[model samples]
Target: MFHGLIPADRYYAYLSFRDIESMPNKENVIIIQTVGAVEQHGPHLPLMTDAAIGLYIVGKTLEQLDHDKSPTIYVLPPQYSGYSVEHTSFCGTISLSASTLTNVLMDIGDSVYRAGFRKLLFFNSHGGQPQVTEIVARDLRKRHSDLMLFSIFAWDLPNIAATLVTPHEFKYGIHAGEIETSLMLVILKEYVKMNLAEKEYPPTLVPDGGLLRIDAGLTYAWMTKDLSQSGVIGDPTEATSDKGEQILASLIASFKKLLLEIDAFNSHV
Candidate 1:
């Protein structure tokens, strides 16, 4: 029951102590920890939006893999709360401090390493905490040189945004906008308040020949309040379940490929 969408045998917590001890090739086990956030995703989407998306992606990807032929992969329980200081002004956001998140992830990695696993991957869905995961991954690697640590942002793996959204939405819809809303529509349709969805974008100050931007090559420190009053930074009005489905398919395909590659990867260093 605790396994949720993940296969019962592949859910890390489902394994008994003896079961884990008996597992063969423990060094090759790919332990994925889905990192998400409990934060504001505008009035239209739930606070669990980020967490739900990450879990769904990981769960679906695992489902599609051939257990016997694919690399040994198991998923830890999802980390539902993450660093979300940028959305703290909103009512639903529950943010962990950068240090707190870092320590939590480090502890998880340490436990996994202690349990005889050599590989750990942080599959994060929130836009606010990649830095924290990256820092934790590097620090953990420094501590355990033999541990294989990997981190990835879920949305960064797919290139379907341009096909599903407008050019303007593609660039500014970095938050609870079209991209996320569409995904939510498919992931948690009943929870989505489509009627309440609104289009909003932050002011982009492209000064001195586009030298400055919000989410571009050169960015600034900005909170949701600074750019948008609606707690949204993208056009959710354009989101549709069709687009969400397409996006999910692309993401799953890419994720499956990545997992296989990680299985075969060996560092020369």
Candidate 2:
């Protein structure tokens, strides 16, 4: 509710779409379409982990943009279910097939385009949905080439990976790893029971000789059963809120810059 515009007494009040439309600078509105997942995150973290991180990054970026008087980027409610065949073995992983996800994205993109948002960013946190996102981005580009569209993963931020952790940590930073666990610590600490933290590394099925490149394009070829029995890949015992805070700060800085550049680019093209 606090967009660096209203005073503390009036900050508790909220604004509607009409209210935003009535603003003097209504032409500069940007829309952020966030895609997340309702999948499992080991026993220590909640299933909403991906959505929480997506919302957090966009919220912080919006706050900074408000402070800078940049274009107002509306944070649309996140899409909670994405394409996640890899996590299908998990008990609570609710995921859509690739075709369904792509259809939903296309419909959402069309609705937003019709609403007159010249600049749009499809912000995603779940890497499993990349194929659906790719399809949607490609189609939208072909249809509305003039509209600026960007599909991204928060972890792809410039200088973000380096700033948040060391090279060794990065190597082991997959699935419910240190980074994810730390993020859950900061975002949903009450849900995490540190005593349940455990590490898992299943044997590789791909043959060492030449299987590495075999079916490389077959996304989601390996299911959770193929990966680990416990559905965990790295150590979560060392996760802490301090590390999450550092990652959050680094991500905010990177996102603010990216949004600004997108806004500026919209003006030209």
Candidate 3:
């Protein structure tokens, strides 16, 4: 581990209730709960793709922080099964209904709130579940007016990829594409079977509407099966370890800066 203070599991799973009590600071506690899903991501990527990536992001954020300042954030064991209805027809997807997901989060919030934590930040990686997590955050606020809750789904750190990676494949590569494959290459290399990584060319524009996927302002819902047969979109063949490293580094830098501000923010509402 880069930092010696690394927890046993890089999550709350390793800590006992007494451990939280003895912590030096509790006044501005923020539980950064990562939300992900176990679902099919093409043939090359593992079912835990989103969850594993979430863990990497969180771990890197903590690794680079200035612990001497006493950051008040703790990572909870991730909610590994989220809304994955689009991929449920596939063998690997485990999904929760919108209501069930919200209530499950509410249960987590109630327990953590009762334990005296004042804030909950949902760091969601699964794209299908941000709306659900957003509802959960609002539900917590409805019950506890004093709590601070934030829900976030994606990051634009890859905007820097244009200069780093030639013929950047991120825009077309939405699902188990180059960005994710590159990330898996860096974080879980052994698991990524590159020989099996096939390119999935998504329609750059919708068939009837001719709406450009990358250049248009669009928000249409469709199942994963409706798109790629292999459960993939974008070009995984373009992925490289260097690109992944650059992306992760930028992510850590951006997230760490925001984390510092969040640790001290006092909710007005």
Best model per TM-score: 1
Instruction: Give the poorly placed runs of model 2, Cα more than 4 Å off.
Output: 1-27, 159-169, 206-220, 267-269
Q: Better model by TM-score, 1 or 3?
A: 1
- Residue-wise C-alpha lDDT for candidate 2, range 116-212, written one tens digit per residue: 6666678898867765776788898789876667888877886455456665456445778778888878777898878888876546565445435
- For residues 160-247, could you state the per-residue lDDT of candidate 3 as single tens digits? 6555544535455678888888888998999998888998765544654555444225657777777778888778877889988988
Winner on TM-score (2 vs 3):
3
lDDT of 2 at 36: 90
Every candidate's lDDT: 0.89, 0.72, 0.77
lDDT of 1 at 211: 71
What ranges in model 3 sit over 4 Å off? 1-6, 22-24, 156-159, 162-168, 204-217
Candidate 3 weakest lDDT stretch, 10 residues: 1-10
Model 2 lDDT vs. the true structure? 0.72
Worst 10 residues of 2 by lDDT: 4-13
Query: What is the C-alpha lDDT profile of model 1 across 1-269, one tens digit per residue?
Result: 98887788789998899989989999889999999999999889999999999898899998998877988898998899999999989997899999999999999999999999999999999888888999999999999989999999987896586887888788788888998999998999999998999988877555545777787567878888998889988999888899999999999999999999899876645
Q: Higher-lDDT candidate among 2 and 3? A: 3
Clashing pairs in 3: none
lDDT of 1 at 219: 80
